[model samples]
Target: MTDSSVDYGAVFKALVAPLLVMTPDFVILAASDSYLKVMGRGQADLLGQDFFAVFPPNPNDPDAIEDYLRASLERVVATGERDFMAVQRYDLEATGRQGVFEDRYWSAINTPVLGPDGEVELIIHRVDEVTDLVQQLGRSGERGVTGARAELETMRTDVYVRARQLLDVNERLKQTTSALQEALDRQRRFVFDASHDLRNPITGLLTELEVALSEPDSDLHPVLRKSLRDAERLNDIVADLLELARLDTATPTTTEPVDLAHLVMDELERRTLTATVLTRLDKQVVVCASRIRLARLLGNLLANAERHTTTTIEIIVTTDPPNAVLEVIDDGPGIAPADRERVFERLFRLDDARRQDPGGSGLGLPIAREIAQAYGGHLYAADHSTGARFVLRLPFAA
Candidate 1:
C-alpha cells in the first residue's frame, strides 16, 4: 500500500491538550478544540487577533500576569526553547459579557517552532486552567476538611502539585533576581571606573584651555576655543555617566504631591529652545514624586525633543484617571517602530540622533526612563502620525 498523506492540522486541532499557535509577533494563528472549549471562546473570535489585544492585562492587578506571559513568549522566540511559566493570576473576559471578566489561574508553557533557517517561526502556547483547584486550596484552611476520603485524597494530591509548583517558581525568581542584581552591580562598577578615570583628565584639559585662551594676543584663539568646546563636551559626558550611575543605585529620598502640569510649564520656561514650544496643560494633574527627579525627567525629554525637532515641540499634560500623563512630541523625523523600544536602552542611539547631535551622551532618554520606573511609572515612545512622541505615565497622588 502506498503511504497516505497525514492530516497533521486535524490531529493538532483534535489534541487533548489545550494549545494555541501564534506567530512570533503574537498574532493568533489557530487554537486547539480543547483550548476553545476551555477558554469559552469561539474559534472565529480568536483567530487573526493579537494575543495581548485579545487578553489585555487586568488593570486592577498591579502584578499583571500579561507582563510575565509576554516576557516568557519573547524569551521562547529569542532562545528557540520552551518556557514554563509559574502559575499566574490572569483573569479572562467572561463569555457573553461585554465588560466583565472572571478570575483565572493558569499554568502555561510556551514552545517555539523553528523554520528551515533555524529561526523561530511560531510559538505553541499550552495552558492548563487551575482556577478551581486554586480557589479550593485557598479556602481549604478556612473551611476545614469535611469531605469524603476520595475527595480529601484528591485535594492532598493537588496540594502536593501546588507546593512543587510554588517551589519551582520561587527558585526561578531567586535566580532571576540574582542574575539581574549581578548585572546591575557590574554596570555600576564600570560607570564609576569610567567616570573617575575621565574626570581628572577632562578637568585638566579644560583648565589648560582656559589658561591658554585667557592670553589676549594668542594666535591660537580660534583653535583654543574649539578645543575648549570639545573639552567641555567631554566633561558633559563624564557628568552624564556619573548621573546615570547615581540613578542606577539610588531611590528618591523625598516624594510629595507635585502638580505635573505646573512642573512641565516650569521646565519649559527654564529651557532655551530653537524650536517653537507649545503646550496644552491640564493644571490639576498631580502625582506623588520627587520634585528634583521630575524636573530632571522633564528636562531630558525637552532636550531630546530639541535635538531632533525641526520646527515645533509640543508638551501636553493631562490626567488619565489613575495616572497623570505627559506627552512630548516633536515635528521631526519620527522614530522607526523597531527603534522605539531600543531608544530607551542605555547609550543606544539611532543614526538620526548621531547626525542631529554628534556630541550627545545618549543617556538622556535612558535616565528619564529610569526615573519614571523608579516612581512606579513608565516612559515609552508612543505611536504618532507626524513625528516622534514620548509619553510618561505616573500614578496620581493620593
Candidate 2:
C-alpha cells in the first residue's frame, strides 16, 4: 500500500522567514521570498551560487564574519544539531553603488536536514536582521556626542553588549521551544502504543466472558481459565508500564554498596529455566546502587535470555578498573545487526521476538537500560557468535 506524504521542499520554500537553504558543501539551493526581499536580491542572483561568494564578510569590519558563519554551518553538519550565532555585524553591498556597503546586524541560526542515511544533506540558515536596532543605538550615541563624545561612545558600546546578551537569551528560548516540541511528539507516540497494547487483552477477556455468560449450561471452566490468563497478561503489562513511568521521572534515589557477584548468585537461585547456565564471577566486585532496582535489572536480562536462548546461557562478572562489567550471553537466534539499538526502545519487538515469546512484555529491555543509566551505568546488546549477548557496565563502588 502506498502512503501520502507532504512536499516538505515546498513547505520549506514558502516559510515566512529569511531562510537560505544550502547544500552540505555550502552551495546555495533555494532562497525564501523573505530572504530575497530583505537582501534586495533576485532568485537568479542567489540560486546555484556559492553562499560565501554571494554574502562575503564586510571588508570594513575586522571581525571574521565569514569564518564565524562557516564554522557554525560546519558544526551543524558534523553534529547534526542546530547552531545559533550571536548577534553579528555583517555589511551588505549597496543596491546601486559599487564598492559601497550598508551596515547590517543579524542574529542567525543554522539547522541541518539529515537525509535517510543520517547524513546532513542540507542546511537551513535563518537570520533575523537587527540592523535597525543597532543603528538606532548608534544614532543615540551620535546625538549626545556634541559635548561628551567619549562618554556617549562608551554608552553605545554598553548598549551593543546588552543587545548581544538579549540575543543569547532569545536563542536559549528557541532551544527550549524545540525541546518541548520533541517531547510532546514522543509523548503522543507513547500514548498511542500503550493504548493499542492494552486494547488487545481487554477485547479478548470481554469476548470470552460474554460467550460463557450466554451459554449457562456449557463448560465454563475453560472460558474462566482463558479469561484468567488474559487478565494476568494485562496485569503484567500494566506493571511494566508503571515501572517505566517511575524510571522516567529520574528522581534521585538513596543507594548503598551492593556485592555484585553474590547478588547474581542469589537471583540465579530463584529462577528455574530449561537452559544450562554458566557463571564466571569475580568476587568482591561491588557497586553503589539500589539493590532492589539492580535485581530487577538483572532479572529482566536473565528473563530475556531465557526466552531466546536455545541451550546454554553464560553469565560473566568482572571488574574493568573503575567499572564493574557484566555480560549475559545466550545461544538463541542472535539479534540482527541493525536491531541492536532499536531493541531498547519501549514497546518495540522484532518479528522473531514476538514468535519466540508471545507472552513477553516488550518493556523489559527498555526498563533494564533505564535502570542501568539511572546509576550512571550503561547497558547494550553486543555482537555474539551464536545467539544474543547483553553487556552492562556500572561504576565500581568508591
The segments of candidate 2 whose C-alpha lies over 4 angstroms from its true place after superposition are: 1-26, 29-47, 53-87, 91-147
Q: What would the TM-score be for candidate 1 when compared with the true structure?
A: 0.53
Clashing pairs in 1: none
Candidate 1: misplaced stretches above 4 Å? 1-174, 177-218
Clashing pairs for predicted structure model 2, backbone only: none
Model 1 whole-model lDDT (C-alpha atoms): 0.83
Q: Can you write out model 2's per-residue Cα lDDT over 1-398, one digit (the tens) per residue?
A: 43358777677668889999899999999998889888988889889999988877777778536776787788788779998888877788877676688888888989999999999999999999988876666566455636565665677678667765665576567558768988998889888988888888899999999998898899998998999999998998898888888888876778999898998999999888788999999999999999989999999999899988989999999989889999999999989989999999988998888998776668899999999999999999998899999999999999
lDDT values for all models: 0.83, 0.87
Deviation in angstroms for 76 in model 2? Answer: 13
Top candidate, metric TM-score:
2
| Position 150, candidate 1: lDDT | 50
Candidate 1's residue-wise lDDT over 177-281, tens digit each?
Answer: 768988998787656755654665566677767767697577776656677776777877767776777886784468999998889877878877889999999
